[model samples]
Target: MDYEISLETLLQHLGEEEPFPYGSVTPPIVQTSLFTARTLRERNTQQGRNEFGYTYTRVDNPTVRLVEQKIAALEGTEDALCFGSGMAAIASAFLTFTESGAHVICVATAYTPTRMLLESLLVRYGVQVTFVSGECIEEFAEAILPNTRLIYLESPSSLYFRLQDLRAVSQLARAHGIITMCDNSWATPIFQNPHALGIDIVLHSASKFLGGHSDLLAGVVAGRKEHLEPVRRTRELLGGVLDPLAGWLLLRGLRTLSLRMERAHKSGLKVAEWLAAQPQAAKVHHPGLPTHPQHALAQAQMRGYSSLFSFETHPIQEEQAYAFADRLRLFRFGCSWGGYESLLLGWAQTESDANGKASWLFRIYVGLENPDDLIRDLQGAIDALTP
Candidate 1:
């Protein structure tokens, strides 16, 4: 089914085996490393279904396959594969498409490790990458080369949270016979469906929003069967498959994705707006806000926004920023977000504009807590910054 179907049905009931696997509400984790056949002839037959059947857990497992199906349904793709971590899925996709001398066009602000992968590992293999701002279609169009095999994008990308026009980029890639992949972790499928916009592949760091409870590390790659077939083979060879237990936990996480996304969306906007209006916040970088430069484009593409966003303080000292972060009781200082608890991360050194005015920047993740409580927690911290 397509994205038009209700997400509640897709997440709760889709891909569920009839009779509920011994009538249990949840599917059992088929944790065995091997699925054996009684006889050599049956073994050959089972092995023959290697790509589709479960002869081995590393190649495929029942629990992981179930998670893949639900993810495919959520992404509105024909098939999907789960990986041990987000980088595993990303690396597999890159390795699947790139040979020596292949070129890739990537957004400048993609996840840091991804950028590192492109700059370090991929370059070592003779593959070249061009990083673009991704603010306009022409930037991508101009960067394309004869050897360009892929265009990698991360809309509402890390930290600064810049956005790209997925439909535009997808069209550009298709016209050039190049594959397109997008990291959709920021605006989970509940808020944004990248595949529906014609992207060749949709990727997710399921460790974030999809896992919901911060208890699992999983990555997802979804696309047409033809596109994902080679990626699946690469996954098998690379040995980056998701564990069965993590698959089961991911299943648990998917059930509440819609509700959590809704909560995050509302609470996030409330907090972002409040921060934007504050005297200390020089700027807030949330697309949901009308003050955002690309608010119209964001509204055109995404149905709703998620909870992670960043803001800049009005030229605060590094120690002052640290003091503010330390003062907050409710917001935990951590790198990753998208779970039940609120998180904050500040750059200790202030960034300077071209004119050399320094300003401290910070990212906030509004969790499943009451927005008012989180706002109060933030207010207490900002109040601490006062003389």
Candidate 2:
């Protein structure tokens, strides 16, 4: 029988309907630490699956496994591993693949904690990293060495929002026999499939789009079994397994992912377009924008854009950014986005000088609000900022 299902069908199957044959309509959270086997042989088999043989929730949980299977279906991968948080998933994937003295190339603006892992923790253990702008395919190619084991990327990077040419980067990584990993949180599988573009591993902070409500903290990595095994081992060993309740919440979030993403795509474009009209807005960066440097590439690879995007303004200072942010009533000033409520974050203090010239800018995570109301809020906030 053919296994392929349309995206909508996949969403319903993978997100809502658990493969578990339990009689309950809602999946009963498998909140047990141990499963009782009826016989010694059965116990032996199950034990082998667990600690000395399957005895703990840390190693495996039916609830978490269901979430992994669903994400795997959405991401078009062979298998997946789940983590307690986004950084935990990232750490498991890298720590499993990389050893002391392994050389890696990465886009400069990957998630800050991811960068910290490479530069701080991994470096102490002998890993060497080269941060490249990833402006051209050749940039990564030039950075690779004989010892380079992996190429890391975060397209439409978090704060900076730089778009990497995934096809070009994946081709380069494959040519050199190096594995490719990308943070796919921004676009989610509903908007873009990194696997279809030839990426080897796709990572997500399911806390963001996959969890959808900003309620649960979770992460997932999807790829071939070879890559997933190491991640699973690392997660199991490191005790980063996601809880059953969080897994259930993420499953609930995944149900409306298609609808939420579609609305985000349209609303995000409208917001980006409207932001382009503001006088204080120096430049707006979004893949959906015709003026974005990588618009063509984004359009080619992504099915649609999401509400998360960044905008840089002329005022120059974290204070100005925060001032504008504080004035907004609808857009809450905080981190951790992808909810019914919109969020705004000011530039990191490291982004500015003592003299107050803003080196970086604010990012916006638009929510399911009326576009006209959002614009009016932005208009009032911009007007509030004074010299």
Residue 227 lDDT, candidate 1, scale 0-100: 92
TM-score, predicted candidate 2 vs. hidden true structure: 0.92
lDDT agreement of model 2 with the native: 0.85
Which residue pairs collide in model 1, if any? Answer: none
RMSD of 2: 2.8
Candidate 1 per-residue C-alpha lDDT over 1-387 given as tens digits, one digit per residue, 9 for 90 to 100? 455657687678887748666699989988889876666676687654443455888888988988999999888899999999999999999999999999999999999999999999999999999999999999999999999999999988999889999999999899999999999999999888899999999999999999999999999999999999999999999999999999999999999999999999999999999998888888899999999899999999999999999998776556677789888989988988789999998773355655544577789999999999999888888964442
Q: Which candidate's TM-score is highest? A: 1
lDDT of 2 by residue, 1-387 (tens): 177578777756664553445566666688877755557676676645633344578888888888898899899899888889999899988998889889989889898889999999999999999999977887898899999999999987877678889988999889989999999999999988898899999999999989999899999989999888878888888998899999999988988999999999988999889988876777788889998988988899888988988877765666666677777889887788888788887664344556766544668889999877898899888854433
User: Where in model 2 is the C-alpha error above 4 Å?
Assistant: 1-4, 15-22, 45-54, 316-322, 348-360, 385-387
Estimate the TM-score for candidate 1. Answer: 0.95
lDDT of each: 0.90, 0.85
Off by over 4 Å in 1: 1-5, 46-52, 348-357
Error of 2 at 104 (Å): 0.9
